[model samples]
Target: MDIRPALESDLPELLALESQSFHSDRISRRSFRRWLRHHDRVFLLAVDQGQALGYALVTLRRGTRLARLYSLAVAPQSRGRGVAGALLKAVEQGARDAGALYLRLEVASDNQPAINLYRKLGYQQFGCYEDYYEDHGSALRMEKCIRPYAPGGDSRTLPWLAQTTAFTCGPAALMMAMAGLPGGYRPSPEDEIQLWREATTVFMTSGHGGCHPLGLALAAHRRGFASEAWINIEGPLFLEGVRDENKKRVMRIAHRQFVEQCAAARIPVRHADIDQGQLTERFQAGANILILISTYRLDNMKAPHWVVLSGFDESCLYVHDPDLGDTHPRQAADAQRSALDCQHLPIARDSFNAMSRFGSSRLRAVVIVEAGPGTAPTPAPAT
Candidate 1:
């Protein structure tokens, strides 16, 4: 059998196989047609004796380091003969070639055969979707870490933890940075919420609360790590989200309080952008960064986000982004490295600068947490 890219002529056979292989949630001919002509995606066919045995459709979203295996189907005649395995492997290799740090897929919960195959292929279940299919079948979200990622020294390890709540990204990132430092503490979900309570602004664009850079710096300092803050916005932030004048006043009061605590701690607060050059300098100086950025690149939402810059190389900056939702948000892949996992992200130089901000003005803020050296430190904290 020959494995190759699918052509327009293979569409008819593909549609038939898709319909035959699955009882529901099959890709339509129109969608298959679209995938064939799309430049950033790959649609491969396993052919033998001029007949299609299986087909795989994979997607690499723009500005995301994660590729998704959207669809894979093998003809009934070829199922027991390992046609599906070959197609899955080819799509995985294609995703790696496309520079994807990981690949994710959603399969029905009851599809034991597919689930077993995915497990055998090194895909681990990370999430679930209820009633995802038309037949009311729940979906299991599985992910595989695609290898040949950006190489860096093992001395710097930024442990990753997903924010339990959306507004806790800043605190969660601070938690990851602390978890990376020498003698740093490992925080639990409860600890994350507690940290958020201390650092959050109490009000944001539309949510419970979002942590400020000053708040995060203070949070880090209280934990025995030396912290510095750099923010582009001079005045109180998150006030624009509060419509009630009295509520805005309260937010400003809280913001001022956080700043005062930071000042009392002698944390160096700079009113300037933390450009790539400065970021690199800090990395070289042995500092873990908690950057407050906008979530525009991962999603179109112009909101505040926090990520930990754990390591860097000549090609990309490795960070542990706290937010997991909408990490893969585009149809075309970014020319730069994005995220391997929700916690471990690799951002390219130019794309990162654009991603590291909020609103039309692109507000930037970062907290540099520097700690003393340790002997034989591991990249990820031990349980």
Candidate 2:
């Protein structure tokens, strides 16, 4: 099918397509006319043999980070071909040329095929709005950054730029570990009680490793949380003196020097100790905030790590895990008995406190800001 910019004459065909795709009673002709008059709206249509097959509608707003793709449709008969994809690509390129940082869209949650297609195109899932559409269906918000093209750089040869994808803490840690960061600090069950004592903030390292932690630390720093993570000698160190085991020993001897350096930069450092109970109590008292991190795993099992104890009941400790990947209050209870057990590692409320009390240096706390939904514009599809 030939793709072309939509003209006034295509309004009738566009309305007809919309009527066929949506409930005829819902999208009235009046609504279509109103849409046509909207300023800065980019509409496109695809046709073959004088028959309209698809269309896209986009809106370009000034002083925004991204262009919005508001609506896209492929005639029911033309669904399986690449009509929708081509329309999307064209709109993306157009947005990039117009100096947009990202292209954003919303898709119905039940439309798995569309979600998959968007994912394959480097779109990252960001958030969801409940009842965001006409039928009160949920909408999956997705975005793809349109990197400015450099004149001499070969797009084909360059590695894909790492887009700011979101993830929960646990899976994020695992990913970081797998990506060859310094992870795998599977603390001995016996080491748990000691670690909790020295820490003011518990940094749970889960998922891909330090990416979530780094991002969270940066965020916390912005929010006024004094954050620090002990660098294992064998792990990758993104920050100075934040390296593997050998460096840690040196850190212990030169503890004053390390503290001074961290103080000068407003970042604190202490060797890591894992504690389950004291950390939970601190969370309950509001002195400590847990940032649980995780990402989507293939099996759908809950990957919990680095949880903060926000509150507690008789059986469960209310905890916050950042692994939810969205800015919602992600709090869950840890069964008191189970939490006391040596599952992945050993942990106890008093044990962790005792360990911290005896450690040469205590755990460091960092400031972190929680991410939340902002007013993002609705995406329009290609005309």
Candidate No. with top lDDT? 1
TM-score of each: 0.69, 0.39
Point to the candidate with the largest TM-score.
1
* 282-301 per-residue lDDT for model 1 (tens digits): 66656788877676666556
Error of 1 at 177 (Å): 1.0
Question: What are the per-model numbers of colliding residue pairs?
Answer: 4, 70
lDDT, candidate 2, 1-383, per-residue tens: 88888877788898878877765224456655655775555677889899998888776543223367778888899888898888888878777676555567778898898899899888888667687667788889787756642111111111111112222332222222222111123322232222222221222222222222333343333333344443222222222314455554543444444344455655544335434444443332223333332211211232323433333322222232223222222422211111101111111223223322211233232222122123121111111
TM-score of candidate 2 relative to the true fold: 0.39
What's the CA error at residue 194 for candidate 2, in Å?
A: 47
